[model samples]
Target: MSTYKAPLADIRFALFDVLQAETLFSRLGRSEATRDVIDAVLEEGARFNETVLAPLNRIGDEIGCSYDKATGAVTTPPGFREAYAQYVEGGWAGLTAPERFGGQGLPHALGTALKEMIDAANLAWGNFPLLSHGATEALLQHGEPWQQEVFLKPLVDGRWTGTMCLTEPHCGTDLGLLRTRAAPAEDGSYAVSGTKIFITAGEHDLTDNIVHLVLARLPDAPTGSRGISMFIVPKLRVDRDGNVGGANGVRCGAIEHKMGIHGSSTCVLNLDDAQGWLIGQPHKGLAAMFTMMNTARLAVGLQGLGLSDRAYQNALRYARERLQMRSLSGPKFPDRPADPIIVHPDVRRMLLTCKALIEGGRLLGYHASSLLDVIEHGGDDDERAQADALLGFLTPIVKACLTEWGVECTYHALQCFGGHGYIAEHGMEQLARDARITTLYEGTTGIQALDLVGRKIMQLQGAGLKAFLELIEGFCSEHEGNPDLAEFVAPLRDKAGEWQRMTQEIGGRAMADPEEIGAASVDYLFYSGYVALAYWWARSVAAAQTSSQPDAFKDAKLQTARFYYARILPRTLAHKAAIDSGAAPLMALQADRFDA
Candidate 1:
């Protein structure tokens, strides 16, 4: 594995130059998040990951986590707990959490950048804090006053860990089919009885307690999803004074044996009449859980971004160093026996693909986080509402596309290694293995696609898409006459128009037959994602053209923008075709006749 280094330069460029997050932060009243502070945090975070976490990436994969069945406890791979302690002591767990709850209250955009570094350094170790951050978001949004006071502080303080227990052995995607039940007790608490499988960071020895945000059904609740309710179920119950008490009725039945992220414990949590309290209103669990899920989905997208960048970095280094064959034209290194593989166009193609995706995807991820800052702290309600809508639409796209690209980029990175990539010792194989799960968890790519095409576009009448399209159209119009950017501006305008038309067509078809939504969903998602990245790429090109930065930096941005449009953006054509195919081909075959 190549030594992981935080891409602070790109992160800074995205924040200060491309996204202008500093301006957004200032406008949002995040006064403490000055450039100095953000930079310092990023630099320190870089050091932490480089010196501490990066070394553990391979170790985590090799040792994995050990589960003690007798005690129902999970011991993370060696050095995992110590690294976490350093992480907590560094005040990283609450980097963007609420100030009232002991967090530094920095902008989430900064946190998102830091998170990418940590994830790239050690993805499995990153999960522990990742879950806790998601849990904190849920509680901050929906927890009761006392619940926040009792649980939120510990979580924010990094004294306690957290987990989201949603999937069960029987029900994975369909929460309506969940069998968990929560019965109210005389003391206003509830007994949560269910078995939640595939719970990340569910059982770990890193923290004093694990606060599980559980989803279950209450008595007299409606059937299916409407019946579900959210609960605060802790592994070790805390008293009113915020002191850890004896074990609640929660235990780890077993940890899963997984292909990747071996350091992060995926547990089978048995909540046998566990004492719990409702976080949000009764029977509105899905809505409350979404508070956390949305946060998680975006973070998961960054996981994809992180892994892809890491793979690219290592592969690029290897390609430039590994001597393979003479260039078709001539040997770039006349003194050497053979030129480095980087001299090959195919290798350049793979490297450029990774670079384009990571840089462009970084913009998308940071832009989403910037919108989050607007939603949380922008003064104008209308702007906040618009930002909220756009963020919702981008969330699924960012999650699904980035993750899918993670898989693709890793494959390219591994291929660059030749047969050496297949060997375990090279670390490319681990990157490939770990990238597989990003698309699977935090809702699968298919689920995110359905949500995008079905809920965001159809049910919401494309409010999110409309807001985003308007921005794209406005940008294209602003730069339409500029000769230098006319190439990008013209194509972006056409695609934005096409995207709007496609959405309207899909909406009309779905109105006639709801199945049309499902049929066109995945393709619609990819189309939207590609177009979204195109807009960001255009913005990047504009930024590069006008900037005072070194020509090297500006040239890289312009070249990548060209590559994205020339090579990657055309992917929208195939997706649009697939979307136009409609439900006929998809639903033609019967369930039992799939084999035919």
Candidate 2:
């Protein structure tokens, strides 16, 4: 597999230039959190991911993880524990965590950027702590004071790890059918009894304890998601003094052997009368759990960003190095036995394809993070509400499209490597394999699609969509005539037009036929992806123009923006057409039709 390097330059550029993320934090009144501080901290995180955690990415993939049934212990692939130590020791463990709990209290934008770095270096390994970060977020928002004091401190300090336990052997996407039960004790605690399957980082030896945020129905509560209550069930209970207590009721029945992310330790967790405590109010667990799920969904989108970067880097390096037939016009490298593969237009197209997604997607990913920072830290109530609404609307888009496109980015980037890409040692295959989970977990693309089409669009009687279009329209009007970015600006306006039409069509069709919306959902997702990326590209183009830099940076910026508009953005057409195609063809045949 190809060795990984942290893209420190591009990351810094995204922060300081395109998103002006540091400036956003500054405008929010956190003046102490300057660009210089953010840059230095991000640089350190890069090295940790590059030199510390990245090596184990392939190591774990090759050796895989181990589960010792006799001792009921799990071991990560070699070097993982040590790398985790370095990551925590570097003080990156608490980037976005609350300062009272020992975190640096950095903005969520920085946390999102840190996420991108780690995922690119080592996706499987990156997942371990990222999951913990999301768990901490959920607890901070919903957990009671005692629960926070008991668990959040250790988690923020990286003294322990965390996991989200929602899916079970019998149910996943539909939580209405979950069988787990949470019964309260007179002593003010609860007992959780049920089986949770496909739990990532569920049980591991890297930490003294694993704090699980689980969803289970209360005995006398209402049915479906409404009946569920969130709980804090650790692998091994911790005493009042924070010492490790006896084993909790939760135990790992077995770790799943999966296609990719073999080292992640997906588990089937059996909670047999497990001692637990409710994090939120009775029958309000789904609302609380969404705190973590939404955060994870956005992080999953960045995973796609990381995976795309990995694939692009490998394929770009190979294109420049690998030699083949001479140029059509003339040999670029006359002395060489064969021309470098980059000379091929189709190869250029593939390289450009990955670049378009990664670079543009990075802007949207980081922009959303900054919006989150504004939501948390901005001084004005109006600004915070605006940030909250905008972030909510885009989160699913960031989650669904970036991940879906990210996999395609890897697939195409890997394809450019030809036969060499298929080999394990080349690293192209690993990039593809590792990115596969970004779409499946947190919520599937289908679920996210339903969310965007069903929930986000209709929010506040189209207030969310109106607010978003206003922002995009404002940008297009201001930058329309600029010679430097006219090419990039025009397509963005065009895409906004496309989105308006698609939204109306989906809305009209779903009103007449409900299932029509479900069938067209994924396409709606891609259409939104196209529009989001277009907005970011316009912003990025503006960034490139405002910078008084050498033409190399300027040229590359405009070229990438053009590529995104001209090539990648056009896919929305096919997606829209497919959405308009409706569910008729897809659901036409019953199961018995195949048998016949």
Candidate 3:
């Protein structure tokens, strides 16, 4: 497999060329994310992931995490503790954290790219800290003022890590049905008691302290999701003097033996009167938890982005190096027994699809990250609202679309390896198993689709969603004259418009037939994901042409942009057609449709 190169040219194309990300940085007065700064961060992130993190992946899966039932502590695969110690000592833990809490307060753009590098290098190890970053972000936003001073600094510094304890074994999708409980204590805190399953990073030796954000119902709390509240339950309680104290009440029952991500522990946590403090308003816990959950959903999507990129790199490498059947035209490697696999049309097609999806996803992911940066750092409230509202609608898209395609891209890339892909050492099989959870975890594709069609798109009568569609249309209008891009651009725009019309029709019909949303939700989600990618390709071509830098490298970017549009961008049409019809085809099956 090809070792990661950071894909700097492509990342530069997305930011400086297509999105003019540095311009936004300058305009927003974020002196830190300048072009030089971004380039440096990307370089360092790539090296850290490649050197410190990647080597542990195969070994991690081999040894996996272990639970000591007697002490109820989870131990990660060997070398993880030391790796995490170095990672924290480097001050990388708070790259995106707010400065007030000792964070670097950087924008999401750098974070997004950095995450891709780490995930692609070693997803199993990467998942552990990713959860902490997200959980800390939520606490910083909603935790009490004193709580920030007490907790945020250590978390931001990576001395302490965090986790979200929301999922119960029986209540995976429905937070409203969670049975965890919280009661008042004499010490002005709450005593939390709950059992949470499938908790990633729930128990680990990577940090001195593990802060768990749990969802529990109070004595007088409201019923359902409305009655739930969010609490901060520490594994090892902290004293007022910043001293690490005794175990509170939380313990690991057993770690799950899953098909993938074995390096990271997924625990079933049993909280026996754990010392806890409420993070937000009573019965408003679900809302606050979603803040972290949604953030996680996006992180999960980026996880997929990284997987697809690495998978493509691996497959593309194998295709060229390994000799295969002779080409139709002629044996390109005339002296060899056969020809390079790249000479085959089907091989090229698969390669092209993987590239299109990964690159397209990279574009979309970065754009979303930039929007978040603008929302947080920009001076103008209107600009911030525009950025925030737009990202709010796209988060589900970013999370759902990229992860689903991540799985698809990995499957195709693995197939290119033929029988070799399925083996343990080849590492392709790990990508497949690891990428699968992204869909089911961090909200399933079904839930994300429902969030898109039912909540995000329809909310405010489609104002935020319409704004995004309009943005894509505006780009087409501006770039209509570029002939090289026009061939790919025009058809994509038409298809997008077709999908938009179908969605409008279905959305309007949804008022009378609520089930319509559920029936076509996945199709609609995929349809939007399809056009969103087209928009990325179009922007890429425009930006690559307008690149400020010089010759050889920029030309390569323009070529890759063309490759994406010409060879890979057509998949959107299939999704559009699926969205435009056949809800009945899906519904046509009898009541025993699921009977196996």
Q: lDDT per model, in order?
A: 0.91, 0.84, 0.82
Question: TM-score, each model?
Answer: 0.98, 0.97, 0.95
| lDDT digits (tens) for residues 139-175 of candidate 1 | 8888888889999998998999989999999899899
Span of 10 residues, lowest total lDDT, candidate 3:
1-10
| TM-score: model 3 vs. ground truth | 0.95
lDDT of candidate 2 over 216-272, digit per residue (tens)? 988897877778888888888765446678889988889999889877888889999
Q: Kindly report which residue stretches of model 1 are placed more than 4 angstroms away from their true locations once superposed.
A: none
Pairs in steric clash, model 3 = 222-227
Q: After the best TM-score superposition of candidate 2, give how far the Cα of residue 5 lies from its true spot, in angstroms.
A: 1.8
Better of 1 and 3 by lDDT: 1
Badly placed stretches (over 4 Å) of model 3 are 1-3, 239-243, 548-570, 580-596
**Sorted on TM-score, highest at the top, how do the candidates line up?**
1, 2, 3
Model 2: worst 10 consecutive residues (lDDT sum): 458-467
lDDT of 1 at 393: 92
